[model samples]
Target chain A: MSLLRLRRASLSYPAGGGSVEVLRDVDLTIRRGEFVTVLGRSGAGKTSLLNLAAGFVAPSSGAVEVDGRPVTGPGADRAVVFQDDALLPWLDASENVAFPLRLKGAGRAERLERAAALLRLVGLEGHERKNLWELSGGQRQRLGIARAIAAEPEFLLMDEPLGALDAMTRDRMQELLLKVWRASGAGALLITHSVEEALFLGTRVVVMEPRPGRIGLDEGLDFSARFLEGVPARALKAEPAFIAARERLIAAIHAEEAA
Target chain B: MTVSATNLPERAASRFPSGGRPALPAAFLRRLPVFAALFTLTAVFGLWWIASARGWAPPVFLPSPDRVWKAAQIAADTGYASATLGQHAAASLGRVMAALLVTLLIAVPAGFVLALSPVGRGLLDPLIEFIRPLPPLAYLPLVIIWFGIGEGSKILVISVAMFAPIAISTAFGVGSASESQVRAARSFGASRFQTLRHVLLPAALPSIISGVRIALGAGWTTLVASELVAASRGLGYMIQSAAQFLVTDMVIVGILAISLFAFGFEILFRLIERFWLPWSRRR
Candidate 1:
């Protein structure tokens, strides 16, 4: 069964005197354990779609269903990793990772153990006691990922989680995320502007058009080599299929722009 | 190609000392200059003692340091004004602490409500603005009429003095937390209350602590003002009564006690800030 689905959803925001439509008639589905990436331009309402899925905002006209339930408000079932590394400044790495579990009323020992394990997963084992302010930008974002994944949410929503990292760190985070995702077998809806990232990490890629945003194209790639464990991402990018997929997405985006 | 030069002395100084142990206690103590502080205080006292000996300054107007010390010892032995020196100092401190506690309890929640909820702000902003600029002493007449020049009046005076700054700073701090933090919290499935608890409150803490510090200083200043009008027991009462009787030594002692209390409270608050908000300890 599909783990998450968005059906003919429309999202609008108040602007000037009237409403500005951000997303219109958007339909999407992700099977359990499938990784999907929503690729779009800067103003293509990709973040709005992720927000709707995260239950931060509700669809104006349609339904956002997650794991067989209609998403009304945010719940622990869906966790978000934001682009700007939104680890709480007052909390150290361990406490930040344990926030969801803490809110769920888990005991200190249990949450601390779980948090320590998650920190290790993110290669931040020794830095668990470090405050968010003391960390480098890349470390903070890695901690953000740990916080999001600590709860083992069924669906992890990432909104350009590596956008702020420099090239070296970004490459490392991308590798780390793919490894974590495969090992955990959790579903993800990654929102990104990078065609390379979409091609590399996603089982399927959906291209979104600008303005009254709608899916411009959708392509499936269930081939095992693209997102397998122990496969370097650069090798995948160098593949002929990967280059073809990238060209196809660029053509679709340009067509949407011309139209 | 140009040759680069290196400074051996500068590099040696920059390197960590060998053995990786803390510096010797004697070396650290020498750097502290305990004697310098003592010498400065003693020089001031010597100048005052000389002036009194020469009759260059009136003894009653500015008592000799020795005379002030003697007067303090006597007051400590017996009592200053109506109570002992300890009793008077305790009374003033107790009032300030009680008033501060009450002000914090009331202002923090009110400030958060006002800043978070628009309707709350709309209802309270006018009253807050009206009361903010009026000196707490301006309420002295009302306080006397309502509480009848007793402990209640005194506490009310300090509470009134303390409340506005605490509330205003809290409101400003709550309002000043970046919208991005709020948005990020919401994205993580946090409810409105959870977002406030997890994100808003912690982000506003430094400002709120500063507000408390300011309120404490204000509270101390108003302690004597309140006692002057209403109290029969406190440092202000001791100073006022001593002045009436031309006990210049006792008045100086009372003034010194109040100054000491204020300084102590400031240091205590700094220590608490350091302990609880360790992330803010930059250097």
Candidate 2:
């Protein structure tokens, strides 16, 4: 509930005849109410970093710990929002959201109530019974979040949840994400290739380096915090300070790629 | 061909005052395939009628459609080989459906195991492959020897013939779940069983329905082969009896009945798919 930490974690996959190191002694942490955005070029182990934190893959060296306990496998404490949305097409909106509850052995009535409430929380109340295919990419992503949060996990791990949305919807979804984060008070770790998205959303942003991926830069930012303090997202993002930081992160990623 | 030309913004409606002969009416054009089917049936029937009337071979060899129809009426009245046409038809249908049910229960679970567990696949994959290519006739005698020439053996023969398609298709459907989908389920604390139930099962449904479609065809075909061994009341038995006595019209009637019944079930399964997995149609 308080802290999720990766303590010098590394992962490598046996490929061909040799092993390819995916993450090299990566160190990171997210506290409750903190939104940590990871930004990097492709192959920078951004996803591997999240996978370690979410316990989808075991770190070959060191450890991922939520609070202080070592992470072993995927659990109810860590829910992930996949880039592809990954909502079951066979399930309607409400049923998809209710899935986590069902897995946890919640009774049908309780699951339905929780799902219906989460649908409202995600601004998908009226579309509860709608098929997943009928929902737009943005709406489906929102439903994915609802499903992820259905179990009230300690942390929310998202892999480019809004990466597929059109520009207008992406911008709108960014604000919605902040709203949900503020409401849930769950620690969040999101990875994206977009520097502006990283700069705009993260309370702390971590930039990753590729080819034996490692952390290149880690810093705290006040933009998302300020937005949560009732500043309009557009006005805050248009600020000169925001523009300067976005440029700096973009430069860092490109500079790493060139290296 | 002129669709693009007529749709251009620069074109005026008056440029084609009659809308190009009304384009053969959209509904009528849509039914063109139906017309083609009807035409083919009629042409075949006409050719057969003409051939029989002119003594093309002998009525004993190629019976006219009316002769087949009269044979059907006569079978309905006097029965064939100790059973009426209705009874024979019912017996054939019952055997196939029983085999289908048995195969579905066994084969679907076998499919799930073969797909989910490597050891299960290792154990079952070769067996399914072994049964897949074995014609029902090849196995019918073996089944009769094992289970005896009773309803059980006949059903078993048909069920074994259906086993491979249903099981293989189930495995194929189970494999269709995306990596992220499985990962998502696990992240929600879904156990292996829960994941299989919630994600893999529904994901496999469209494929399972299709597998059943193929399996039903196998079931019907194998029903005839199975009935070859001491079947007293089936369309296949009636046809076999008719063939021995040179009742060519009755044989034609049996073949037509089987074909029509198979075609009817195919349509029925399609409608079930439409109703149950309506989302599958989006693809």
Cα lDDT computed for each candidate against the true fold: 0.81, 0.88
Put down candidate 2 lDDT per residue, B1-283, tens digits, no spaces: 1122213432553364555474677687556566777898899989999999888979889987788999999888899889999999999999999989999999999999988899999999889888899988997888888889999998899899889988988998899888899998988888888889999999898888888888888888888788887999999999989989999999998988899899899789778877888876563
Error of model 2, residue A230, in angstroms: 1.8
> For model 2, how does the per-residue alpha-carbon lDDT over A32-131 read when each residue is reduced to its tens digit?
8999999988999999998898888999999999879898899888889999988888778888999998897889789889999999988998997899
List the per-model TM-score of the A chain: 0.94, 0.97
- Score residue B212 of candidate 1 by CA lDDT: 86
DockQ by candidate, in order? 0.41, 0.73
